[model samples]
Target: MAAPGPVHEALAALPLVDHHCHGAVTADLSAAQFASLLTEGAAWPGVSPFDSPAGVAVRRHCAPLLDLPRHAPPADYVARRAELGWQEVNRRFLTASGAGVFCVDTGYAPYPLTSPAELAAAAGATACEVVRLERIAESVAAGGVTAGGYATAFEAAAEAAVRRPGVVAVKSVAAYRTGFALDPERPAAPEVARAAGRWLARGGRLDDPVLLRHVLWTAVGLGLPLQLHTGFGDADLRLDHADPALLTDWLRRTAGTVPVLLLHCWPYHRQAAYLAAVFEQVYLDVGLALHHTGPARCRAVLEEALEITPFRKLLYSSDAYGVAEFHHLGALCFRQGLAGLLQDRVDADELSLGDALRIADWTGRDNARRLYGPPVSEPARDSGGPPTRKV
Candidate 1:
């Protein structure tokens, strides 16, 4: 049996909730790899994956946008899935989720979503279990295409995620493809801020504002939480849009607006935590830097999250993408990461283990429940296991 990864041991010690993530699909191994990963003497550490998976993990999307090129088409999405060899991604996660995972976040708006009902139906068919749909608006789409193209994608994806069962929230991945450099195609928020008018005055792609407004209206009706992807995104997005500070005004306007989850607190940690502390409708997700940075940086992020954000308002998730290890590692970071943070506790530390545990619990899937919660008619399982068990 292989030894478990450091992150896994940490997770076993610290309870956590995986609040944010996108569950894609995987398929390859003849059988699900759940046993080997979960077995006592398997080669690698932690539970093996269940073969046959789908969905693009978040890590693939994490690298700096400047270094990135284009987003993958649906077909390309599948081609890019990592080969786990014989790893089992799902069953083990299911085990954790069922034990106390909290919840799983299947990506939100399917940018350039094709069909509404069909997409919704398709997700329902998958074992991955779609929890929430992230909706892309013209703000998201406009950054990529003419306003019309953006709107079409947003409308279709929004409709699909809203209607699916087990779905409780709809998130808007509002990052753009174009940066300060402008292009006729692939525009994100930065482009929208400057080009919106001239582009509109000249009839530049039909006003993204109109389309974004439509998206906001449609989602507000759904009554699910809206997750705004913010900070340090790709090359195309304006640094301004990435800041949670900017979002506060947006949040203020929508004060009573449905709840919102702010993912990727990049450049804006303190500000993000302040917002989480101030509004019941707002929460923050910090998952990326957990592994890349040493435990200290991870601890800083966690401490800030607890400073103001109500324990309930705080959420957890791998914010992780890429392969199974990414997911496993991210989940572990949330658990152990908090414990490490607590290790430095002082009057300045300001947070308790109980508070950290609550936040950890939130990270798993609690945010999804706050947003897309399973239907009352559906049988509820903690589904994902608790973050701190010795699976």
Candidate 2:
């Protein structure tokens, strides 16, 4: 690896604001459990996730934090993790991430996970909430609300959820639930009641397109930044419907509403860039893809996302769930990858050093601050470096 340049040093020293992420698991994970969390895909009997890019990157980057050598064997790494226990592992990784703030999605949890306060304490950072619309809707259904009253009940629930202290934003997993290819218009009262009746009867995950559109429009009414999971998720998502471009018509209809943040956006990062460029209310981050693509390929992904994206419209996030290693790995990749790309531009005289540094600050921290409010705690600054200018 090359030595750190001025740009790399600047980014390395900057504390990041992870605009979207989830809590790390509190309990110790068995080898199989750990393997399952490593990949978005299911763990097969013969194949190990350790051979993949994300797995290799974890060994190469995260092993050293556990007092093991870089690129340690998978068995050795897992054993070392078990030996250290969950708390110590969480502490080492989250603290090493250098993120000053974490906006956690308190929605999906198949296993017991840390709360926002707990996660923040482990990382020594401030934490806020990003309420999941789908989860709230599911809870409303589970409560046995009448279909005719469902819309009113859901809107009230969503309103109350966002009013909770420390709640910064609301999110929709429409891509996973029904994708973005639905009617651009908000569902009418009768349509919502019909959809609710069907969903309540079926009693499964909320997948009704009408209801998904309703929740999205409801998010717009709430007036907080709205995050939509755009591309690159688990098997539940149909990749074809997950493209950010698929929401172009809807984006046009809702233009000037609450900021719509497109999360992940791998393979379709270029499309996301186009949206951010054209839509004032749009922003994006290639977060989960960062740790999965790892350091080596993260730059390419970042480059494409930044190709036409407005400087202030890009933010940083780990989208990390379950494992704490992703918190550290995501930050590492963002700093190293972004620095390399911006530094190259500076070297080529395509961009000035000052502009490069400002772009770094905007994407890493300031953009998020501008979207959400200021951090609960003052952001931690690195000891010695050229001062970063604030936008």
lDDT of 1 at 168: 46
State in Å the error of residue 38, model 2: 0.4
What's the CA error at residue 183 for candidate 1, in Å?
A: 22
lDDT of 1 by residue, 213-241 (tens): 44445565556666666765544466675
Residue pairs clashing in model 2 are none
lDDT of 2 by residue, 55-105 (tens): 999999999999999999999999999999999999999999999899999
Query: What ranges in model 1 sit over 4 Å off?
Result: 1-16, 24-157, 177-209, 294-296, 343-372, 375-391
User: Which candidate number maximizes lDDT?
Assistant: 2
Measured with C-alpha atoms, the lDDT of residue 313 in candidate 2 is: 86
TM-score of 2: 0.95
Clashes of each: 69, 0
lDDT of 1 at 160: 62
The estimated TM-scores of all candidates read 0.57, 0.95
Task: Tell how far residue 14 is off in model 2, in angstroms.
Answer: 0.7
Worst 10 residues of 2 by lDDT: 382-391
